[model samples]
Target chain A: MIDHMSALFTLGNMQFLLRGAGMTLLLTMIGCTAGLFGGFLLAYARGSKGTLTAPLRWGATAFVEIFRRIPFLVTLFLVLYTAQMIVPRAPLFWVAVVSICLLCSAYMAEIVRSGMESVPAPQIEAAEVMNFSRWRITWMIVLPQAWKVILPSAVSYMVMFVKDTALASQAGVFELMFAGKALANRGLDPFLVFATVLFAYFVISWPLARFGRWLEAQLARRTHEGDRR
Target chain B: MAHLDISGLEVRYGTVPVLSGIDLAVERGELVGLVGPSGSGKSTLLRALVGLVPPAAGRVVLEGKDVDYASKASLRGLRDHAAIVFQQYNLFQNMSVLDNITVTPVKVRGRPKAEAEAEARALLARVGLAGKERAYPDQLSGGQQQRVAIARALALKPALILLDEVTAALDPELVRDVLDVIKDLAGEGITMLLVSHEMGFIREAAHRVVMMDAGRVVEVGPPSQIFDAPTEERTRAFMSKIIRH
Candidate 1:
């Protein structure tokens, strides 16, 4: 066991895995951050009413539906092939980023839309009586009230997304799983290398789960405090 | 001219007529009570006045001016002069009592924050929710929230107030608190069209009562006539079925 551990836990090997973990972290941070912004725009477009925005609502719905139904590996390859055609020689990292963004935005839009729906209709009508602009009502009243409903689910989606980013390795992007594959191919025992990879994934994802629970508690407490009656 | 005049107003929800060919008018400072059974279009009439429900065909003359619902400016002008209090209170759950009252004045009307806040305090006092400026809507009783709704409407200083079943949702004991505030507002000579089920209060407080059913106004008269000597057979049936103790 000691000899097996020594072979697996060399300083050079540790550095290789740590760097891969760092890359995975960056990919998740960028993809999720960008996805969140795009998802908000998509959801607002989806929620838009009236004839003027009918096309936008339809398009947003289509985009979310299409990307959500597509498998992640297929999306990566699709982005890869599309990027090759649109801008050949683009870095594989960007291809992976684009694919992650597409997948995350589709999922995030659903999470946001459900959150927005949880706010009662009366809250919106009252704003209308006050002659508040639709934008003002959404930003000032709807989103604020919706946060209590949205936070826990949003955090959980993001945690799930962190795991989803692992799929990027299939596209030749350097991330955690890709590093483990490379070490196993380099004559290290497959079980030990993969076990270390699993531990690394746990190390990253466990804090996210804890943070989501903590945030959910905080939001629940705020709602309770406001609703004493 | 009457303060608000409706002639041949029509509203439909996708081929189902909810209110049709409705005609009613209220003079300035008149406290008009609109009492009717469920689905009688009492609430829809008020919602139509504020442009919440689209009017398919009608003429609404307000403050001696014809209101064109197709025109956004005209609709906004109508809201500026008239406000509706919903049965559900419809307070902004995210905001405190004070912000609920002051948001429109300060944010939309461009009134100074300090001035709007000061007037909101005064309105809160008038509604008997003086110290609740910091409380959220969920933290208050239904009666208190309804009072806050009233204060929110009054904050706009509207010339016409539409009360759509304002007291319908309150607890029996809590009904008096909201009704008392409406009574005080009526005594102050504010023009109002209140839709309520409290027949006894309407008889005592209304300058005129309008009886409606099945998308039409069955009768319009003094409260004594509508309640005691109702001219319409529908009104008599409705009056007898209220189950008043």
Candidate 2:
């Protein structure tokens, strides 16, 4: 029988996997921050009215549709391969991180658009009549209410983002899944290495999943109380 | 010159004309009541005067300045002169009553925060909502919400205020409270153009009554002449139906 702890800890293999886990966490943080910011711009462009913003709205819609239809792995490979042709010596880590952020942004754009749609028309009209500039109305009145509607779903998307970082290994980045595979290839027990990787992922994802549920419960309670009044 | 003058005003939703060749004027400190059946364009006329509904063809001249709807600066200046309270009492659900009353003055007009708050408190008291300053809109009854909406409009200190079926959304018991507040405003000599189905209140409060039918002004006269001695056939028919109902 294979000794699981010995296989995981021997020859600094555990330390290598821990570094990979750290890289995964780092990628998620950077990707989510950039993705969420880009997604907000996309949401505004996609949902804006009038003939002036038509081209921007159309471009945002096309981007979302194209990215959402393509599989994440294919998108990652295409972005990386195209990028390598332009900057042959560019770091694979940045290429993978940028690709992941772009992919996550397309998904988040739809989430944000739906949240914006959930705000009532009269509320926006009220702001307009009060002589608020368009941006002030959107930033202060619309987004505050939209954020409440999107908070739980946005947290869940972050959890999905954490798992998606494993795809960075396909681009030759040394993330958690890549580390486990490399250790197992050295004739170490595959089960022990993969189990450790799984545990590491759960450590990161479990809290996010719980937090999403907690937010949903809190929102539901507030809505219920609002209805009672 | 009239305080508010609308000449050759027109509004359309695509191919359907809502208001056509409408001309009306309100003098300073006069209360003009607009009485019409549903879809007669009374509400659209009020909305157009405030630049809410862009006029298809017309001029709204307020205090000798012809409103230029295409220009943002012109619209801003127009908003300072006029405000509209809708049938739904569109209060900001996210703000407290005090914030709702003070936000435009503090944010748009650059009024001092403490001064705006003090005025808001006084307006609340005038509207009979003295102690409900911190309450959210949902926490108030429909009547109280409408009163708060009136106070919010009053906070802007506009030269003219428009009321478009402001009591239409309230309960029967709640309607009286809102109308009472409007009565108090009429007593203050504020220039008002009120579109209402409350015939009795209109006759009681309005100095002149404007009758509209199918997007056209059919008659304009004192309440006694419009209600008791309407000369136009359409006005007589409209008034008789309303009185019977």
Candidate 3:
């Protein structure tokens, strides 16, 4: 019931979609940066030892578990509605950004915690004998080794986060998916418009995926060379 | 006062005792070698003295002060005065040989990097590892890594050094090179407690040798007396078995 050819390559609709993609890119950047920072703090709290950090450890664990267990769609809707209740004029865009950031941070915390756990106990013990303080050992010895284990998973999460940004369109933000829907509503063929949307996502994610693979390869080669001696 | 002292030292792991009633002393400039059958707690005594193993009972006195192992401040004080080298070398794998040697002095003692690096280079050359400062730990052989670990400990300049079977992990041909370095340290009047299985090296390098069995000291005397004229039945039997091998 529509002309697929005319809808497929229209410049005006393509420009609108590109603008939406730009917003999606901006959201991904802001969300990932904030999420990564929060996740690192959460990871520290979870792994900290001694009686003084006990309450902080418990609170961080509870936060990660609760956020990770809840569905992202439900979290987004809850946050958006809660913000609306507190501030009736709150922008939907900022609401979407905050919700996604909170969700991704929980996942990032687990990724980083596992990486830190993989560092050998003897490495820390050696640092202890050398009279390095607890903080110095964790920051200088533990985290640098952990970062090598954290990077690949972190990049994959970034790709997933970019894809998840499409959900923001549900909150009436004019992101990439929303733009595609707008074009489809103008009597254009729905299949053609969505197929272009799907292709646009591929264009964004493929490079990031490739980059993750390259990083993993580099790490493996480094470890292999270390073993060769 | 003894330079290092352990009296009535007892160590347990979850109700299983590894060391019991261990009393030992080392004077300044003495190299005391600990020889024992496997599971006789020779290494546990070294670990306990270094504050790596918490003692269930007894006191460790260094320079006339008892170390309260349970207190963080006391443990830090003990660590500042003593360092241990493990059987596995335990070098920081993430660092180069130079960084490994210089890290403690620069980071812990707040020494200037230029001074630390210069001293580290001199220590490396002393250990016969000159020109290998930029190499990673894994790039070196077992003997080379152990030598680097010794250099790392020397950079701390602790009052006492504990060598826990430092050459046990090296190849037979490689053992002599590492042993030569420790001999040089001994000749320099460095105070050390060494746990080694090389009977010949023990006879040659140790000023006094302590033989252990079943978590107790069986004999403590000059290496000639312990190896050649043991007073205990267990020491005689252990020596006979070792000689057969």
Best by TM-score: 1
The 0-to-1 C-alpha lDDT of every candidate, in the order given, reads 0.88, 0.87, 0.87
Candidate 3 backbone collisions, by pair: none
Can you rank all candidates by DockQ, best first? Answer: 1, 2, 3
Residue A146 shift from truth in candidate 3, angstroms: 3.4
Mind giving the per-residue lDDT tens digits that candidate 2 earns over B1-245? 88888899999999788999998888888999999889999999988887788889998899889999878789888888788898884787777899889989998889999999999999999989999987888889989999999999999998888998999989999999899998888856579999998999999989999999899999999999999999999999999998888
Compared with the true structure, what per-residue lDDT tens digits does model 3 show for residues A1-229?
2467665577888899999888888888887788888888898888887798999999999989999999888888999999999999889899988898898789899988888877877667778877787788878877877877888989888898889899888888778998999888987788888888898888888898899899988886785233455
Instruction: State the lDDT of candidate 1 residue by residue for A1-229, as single tens digits.
Output: 7888899899999999999998888888887777778887899999998888999999999999999998899999999999999898979999998998898888888888888888878778778877888899889988887767777887788778778878888888899999999999998999999999989988988898899999988887776444554
Those runs of model 3 whose alpha carbons end farther than 4 Å from true positions after fitting are A170-174, A181-187, A222-229, B14-18, B37-40, B211-221, B224-245
Docking class of 3: acceptable
Could you say which candidate leads in DockQ?
A: 1
Q: How many backbone clashes does candidate 1 have?
A: 0
Per-model DockQ: 0.57, 0.38, 0.35
The window of 10 residues in a row where model 2 chain A has the poorest summed lDDT is: A220-229
